[model samples]
Target chain A: MEIKLSAPITKEKLAALKAGDRVLLTGTVYTARDQAHKRICEALTRGEDAPFELEGAIIYYVGPSPAPPGRPIGSAGPTTSYRMDPYAPALLDLGQAAMIGKGPRNEEVKKAIVRNGAVYFAAIGGAAALISKSVKSAEVIAYDDLGAEAVRRLEVEDMPLIVAIDSRGCDLYERD
Target chain B: MRELDVKEITEAIAGLSKETNVSLSEDVKSRICMMRMKETDEGAKSILETIEKNIKIAGEEDIPLCQDTGLACVFLDIGQDVHLVGGSLKDAVNEGVRRGYTEGYLRKSVVTDPIRRGNTGDNTPARIIYDIVPGDKVTITFAPKGFGSENMSRIAMLPPAAGEEGVKDFIVDAVRQAGGNPCPPVVVGVGIGSTFDGAALMAKKALLLPLDEHHEDPYYAAMEDELLERINKLGVGPQGFGGDTTAIGLRINTAPTHIAGMPVAVNINCHVARHKSVTL
Candidate 1:
């Protein structure tokens, strides 16, 4: 079913999402890929604060190209999600509500999603050019030296996605 | 012998590097369209449509097709009867990459060091493979390989006794393990019968082949058809939403092998499948 979801979603709303539901997400989301994920987890392990508020946050796994003239971003799309598996459960434990990426998450991530009422959304992989049109604005938030891997705050409009895994621990990847 | 200037090579590569990222060739577009027609699943069909839209948008707006513009891989086939002058071929290629990436607004995805992990900032130092041919012409094939699929690629050295079944199994398994990670409806290149590294190179090179073409030998041609069918049946679908189009194309390139070893490499490429060539 087609659903429109705004970011900073509540646990109640997250729980209502099911695997294979089409989502058009709008509002502010954070971009973090492999390097950024490692750093975020490391900071949490060091008992330091996350770069942004974790509660009700939607983190997108992406490393986009540099923005060209007259564009807010370039080729923004989801990267593979498995690389973030190690760090995802902790963020979910801390109240991060959803993750945007392509590919299946590990068992631990799935369990954590159910435990914390989170969802994993799959953006079309390699569909960057089309995806970029949804980004209304983007600003680098932290880890500047990481270049494309830097964390960014992006305002997206009607960003299309599919619920690859849901709060109830069902997965679209594992077809029966 | 024909005298060729490396400066000319640089200019050609620079254009090719940007051109490849901005637009996909007709062969790839047609294959995707064909798959879209064949796809039955609602979610998968929509994803295919989105891909088609993405391609059109990229071409129209001069935007890159994907965010991971990738590590520049340059294949130079220089004819034996040509003498290169004016500069180092390596430097020329790197310069071309630098200019192309910077000018085209393509992502600089390369790192200066694997361990230290510093962005090169210009996407230079292309992974260049050189070959010498009989004619007095130089052909450059440029493919920017994204790590998303590159990471899923594998090289396995099997016992010669593993035979055809084992090789087929390995290729299929690689795609299975890759699953949605490499971006399904992937293009798979299988390299068999060569030495370890050669097999890997061949597998990567095989991706440059036109998707609609088969190997000249009927034996391997049939194998290509079989492997393509098997991979698509994985149901990984477009973006792993579950459908019959797990892979769009599969190519196999082989070489003479050692007596006791059968090295196989599977190089998986995302649906973008960006590759272009220039003859200088």
Candidate 2:
């Protein structure tokens, strides 16, 4: 079944999700990858405010190509999730409700998902051109020096995703 | 001896770089279409269809097929009889990469210092693999390699006694371990029987081989056929969703190695498997 969801997804709504469910996510989502994740965790460790609002946010693991003429963004697709695994639990602890990336999360990340009622969604890997069509608008909000790795707030419309792991810690990857 | 201007090389590189990123090559596109037609799993089939759509959209809009346009891997096969003129070859190549990426709006994915981590801004300083051949022309092959699969590549120095079975096992296991991360329906490049570093280089070079072609030697060709079958049976599928098309193709490149040690390297590439060549 196709599940259409908007941003600031609540735990109550996320609880109903399970592995292998198709998701059409819309509204606002933040972009963060390896460097952004590291910086966010370091800021949190230093007790400084996160660069963006963490609670109820869905973070996408991507670093898009530069926008061409007449487009909001360039080919934007999910990077591997495992690279962001180390910092994922920390973000989940702060009530980050979902992550859109490709591949399986580490065990700690899965455990944290169960603990915090977060979900892990896999956007199609390497399908950037088609995926970019879903992004309506984008603006870099923090760490602009990181270039492609900068944190961006994106307004999306019907971004296709799959529930790779759910709040209950059931993983689509684990299915035989 | 024939003299060639480096400016021609620069112009060729710039155009080829943009062209390869925006358009999916015919061989790879056909392979994906063939796999999609034969795939059974609904999710896998749907994913393949999405990939087909992405290819078309990218070509039509002149957009990159993937976000990671990748660190430019430029291979130059220069003929020994040709005298390179006008400017330093390296500078010309980097300048070409700079113009191509900046003009094409491809992502500058390179960092000057691996540890310090800073974007070079224009994807300059390409990973140029230069070779000298017998003729008087330069052949440039540009393969923008994405790290989603690069990170999964492995190099193993096995005892010569371990032999062919050991190599096969290692390559298959590497793909299995990689799972969904490298993006399945991958093109696997294997380099065997060289020095440690050479093996790894060969593995990456193997990626440049056209998917429609096979190794010249029938022995290695059969090995390629068997290994591809074994990998597909792992059921990694398209995007690892579970199906019969885990790997679309596998290529093996080999060189002479020391009697005591046999080196093997596996370089996996996403379905994009992009490369474009120009002879100047």
Candidate 3:
């Protein structure tokens, strides 16, 4: 059965999810890819504030196409998650609740998710045009120079995802 | 010699760049439809359905099928009998890429430098490969390549003694290791018998071939069929959900190699294999 999740997911809510659970996520999620993740990590190392609130927030690893004249965003979908492995633990410690991306995560990230009460979700890769239907609005919130790689605040409605790794570190990518 | 204006070349490239991004070629679409019919895993089947729907949406709405939009990879078959007028060919290609990325609203994914990475703002300096052939016409093939699958591609150099078995094992192993990362159901492009770089180039070039097309050599064509069977048996399935259709197609290209060494390369392209061609 599919679960309905809203962003700023609570610890209790996240704890209930398990690997292979389908989810329809609604509410706000922040977009960040390689460059933005690097900057966020750098800021954390320097004891500076991150570009957005970390508590209960979910970061989507994506670099979206430019919005057409009338659309809110164009063909926004998950990028490979392994690229962000280096910086994911730090964000998890800062109270980041979940992540939406595709592909396998490293061992370190799996450990971080388990220890920090976080979950990892997979949005279907290459289903960008279909996924974009859920995005209601988007505006760049940081690193505008990064172009598509910039961090953007996206308000998504009923975005489909699958729980690839739960807070307990039950990973869908791993064979039983 | 036939005179072809650089402006015409630029315009053709620009038009192709946009066209390739938003639509899947008929051959690719047919392959996907066939896979969809055979896929059994519920998750994999649903993913394929979404992909099919996305293709339609992208076409009707005139939006890129994927946000990556990819780096412009232009392959040119320039005829020796054709003379270029106006600006240099390279500049015209880059201009075409710049205008296409901007006007088409495709994502600009290229960076100014590899290490000190900064967005070039305009996707410029397309990866252009040229082959001079005997004709009066110039044929350009534009393939927009996303990096997700590109990152999973690999090359290996084996001793000549490793032979056919070694090549098959290597290709299968590469696909196994890539798992869900390259976005299966993928198209596996294999290049055999060239230097390191040449093998890699051939692997990429192989992707430009239609999915239904087989290698010219019967030997290589049979190898492709065998490799595809082994890869699908790995059960990576669509997006690695474990299904029957792990790979939609496999294309192999071969070149004469140095007797001392056997070089092979694997280039994996996601199901959204985007390419278009125009002759000017």
**In candidate 2 chain B, what residue range of length 10 has the lowest lDDT sum?**
B233-242
Return the lDDT, model 3, position B259: 79
Q: Residue-wise lDDT of candidate 3 within B1-280, one digit each (tens)?
A: 8999999989998898889999998999999999899887887788888889989988988888899899899999999999999989999999999999999999999999999999999888799999999999999999999999999999999899998999999999999999888888899888898898999999999998888889989999999899999998888888776787888999998999897989999999998899989999
Q: List the residue pairs that clash in candidate 2.
A: none
Please give the range of 10 consecutive residues that has the lowest summed lDDT in model 1 chain A: A6-15
Off by over 4 Å in 2: none
Please compute the TM-score of chain B alone for each predicted structure, in the order given.
Answer: 0.99, 0.99, 0.98
Predict model 3's lDDT versus the native. Answer: 0.92
Across A15-132, the per-residue lDDT of candidate 2 in tens digits comes to 9998889999989999999889999999999999898889999999999999999999999999999999889998899989999999878899999999999999999999999999
Best by DockQ: 2
lDDT of each: 0.92, 0.93, 0.92
lDDT for each residue of candidate 2 in B154-192, tens digit (9 for 90 to 100)? 999999888889999999999999999998889999999
TM-scores for all predictions: 0.98, 0.99, 0.99
Q: Per-prediction RMSD in angstroms?
A: 1.0, 0.8, 0.9
Which regions of candidate 3 deviate over 4 angstroms? none
Pairing residues by index, what is the TM-score of model 2? 0.99
Which lDDT tens digits does candidate 3 get at residues A47-155?
Answer: 9999999988899999999998999998998999999999999899888999999999999999999999999999989989889999999999999999999999999
Top-scoring candidate (lDDT): 2
For model 1, the docking class works out as high
